[model samples]
Target: MTQRLLSFGLGYSARALARRLLAQGWTIHGTTRDAEKAEALAREGVQPLLWGQDDIEPILAQSTHILISAGPDEAGDPVLNAHGALIREHAVRLRWAGYLSTTGVYGDHAGGWVDEETPLAPSTRRGQLRQEAEAAWQAVPGLPLHIFRLAGIYGPGRGPFAKVRRGTARRIIKPGQVFSRIHVEDIAQVLAASIAQPDPGAVYNLCDDDPAPPEEVIAYAAELLGLPVPPAVDFDAAEMTPMARSFYAESKRVRNDRIKRDLGVALVYPDYRAGLDALAQDEAGE
Candidate 1:
């Protein structure tokens, strides 16, 4: 029997995962807030189910692979608050379940390295929320769960190139600050590899090999896009939204060795330079 896939919150991550699964011959059901996206999903041959507080039960019943990439508002998610118990009601039949989490859960490592077994000490509210959600799902008996701790997600048209093109690219510098990242394509590949061989109760840290200063990524992106890199801004001087500044506050390099060793996966975009270059070529109709 073909395994069924269902995703909550049809964000880029969910959609990317769903698209790959669909292409691999999985029966997929996906959720979207807007009517337009629902139509788009339908056009892509997914079962587009309009979602609300009460719409997931039927969706859960038929799905063997469940991906919860939706935010709490748009996808009835975080599962802890809304659907953990509800999902538990159908856990018996689930082959795999994955929750998209953040490396922010590791908090400020002061440029240290972290792995799957690192104790989670999330400094941000986002991290706390993710840990809470992870715990909630883990509490359910017989629930098949895997947690993916994603670094900053970047893909074509979604990275520093946008700011560089707009002349808003600030080569912001905070000496000693470093961050990790993953391209959406690589993210899809990791998830696809996982789905091919499900591993429950496993936690994976998904990031590329590069862990560099923010300025380096911005400059490389600008160069790739054939734009001038913006003047460097001191972290203290540049105005930053709390959300943006919160990013600089944490510094850690995440390891992807586990996924590679266990899943037999190799990164298609191993660094920002590679990812941006691919996007640039794609933009040029190559």
Candidate 2:
């Protein structure tokens, strides 16, 4: 049987996974809200359907696997709000379903380590919504659901190098603040592994081995670019958008043992250094 994936949101992480699945001959149908992005997805060989405007039921009916990357808002999960009933109706036919969640569901851990078993105690509204969304997805009966709680995701186009090179990078110093992160490629591998080995109702944390302070990552990115490390500003003194400031409200090191042990996956970039090194090389080549 040919594997068919219906991706609810073909964003960065889903697009990365789509690249791998498409190369393996999987029929991919993805949804986007923008006309430009739909065209881009089409160029990449994805059957793009505009959310809310296009008919997705037929595509949903035929999909063997589904990936939900659209996040929840104050109103709640957009996909579920729009198609929860339809997905549940087609649940029996789904071989595997994945939900891209965030480690934010674990909330503030005070720079401590947190595994999948950690209780959900989200400290922010964003985290709370994600936690609720996870529960909502779990409520879908008969869906072979798997949740991947991702940490800060970074890769080629989404790295600190750009800021560091532009001289706009600032090391926001929050005494003990540290965060876990995962490479986009690693995220794709983990998703692929879960597809290969279907484990219903499984939850995994996706992150690199190292969880370092925000300043360290900026400093390293500067070092890689042969530029001076940006000056450090105390968290309280830093000028930042509310969204950027919200990220510092929590500090936790997410564990990725389940993805490695259960999926038999190995991260290509286990730390910021390795991920940054590859990104710098790719930038140089381009």
Candidate 3:
């Protein structure tokens, strides 16, 4: 009775989750856009499939549980574009499906706390599209949809420290501006817990303990690199790309009490400090 776990758009957090599940002897299928990545995924024991191919129906048809990490591509996600008529053909067999969404859906909470019950008010096209994708999946009959609203995601190779070392760290200051975040490992754990015991149509906000201005993270990264902190720039003066600018448009402090109370999760990286310290020390070989 080994459960087969399949992930679409196996990137970032999903990559780690797929690895963990594979280690636990669960059969895994991960999707990627390129053949080389597909080969790499295969090395991890994942059956990798590319989207926009006729082959998807067979793959989607076999997955007992589907975790969508890809979100909607520029061309709109094939998962949403195609819908579940193909999946529905074998609906009785699919048990659980999870969609990784963003807290951006809550949109500009002005540092007010929010949780699963908060109504979505997205401020960006990405967030709007995510909501659309969620609705598309949920509309299918018998599809057990669980949405995880993720905060700023960081882990080993993808956090502020990496930006610091690469000389791209920017200390953008906006007084009282803060954001909640989560470690990729914690995301994997939350997904694991949800799969262990799912609540259909449940929405979980996945964020860690502290909500602090981005400047602090950047400065800490500078300290970890033993370099002077990057120069601060006011949000108004910073030259940001549309994609990056879009991130600053929303403001919120997300709550994770529900996940702790309900999923019984005691986060290993409770805050940025804990996670960053570990990364800094690991770099120093201490």
Write out the backbone clash pairs for model 3. none
TM per prediction: 0.94, 0.99, 0.94
RMSD of 3: 1.8
Q: Which candidate has the highest TM-score of all?
A: 2
Q: Please state every model's RMSD to the true fold in angstroms.
A: 2.1, 0.6, 1.8
- For candidate 2, write residues 80-159 as lDDT tens digits: 99998899899989999999999999989899999999999999999999999999999999999999999999997898
- lDDT value, residue 147 of candidate 3: 88
lDDT score for candidate 1 against the true structure: 0.83
Q: For model 1, name the residue pairs that clash.
A: none
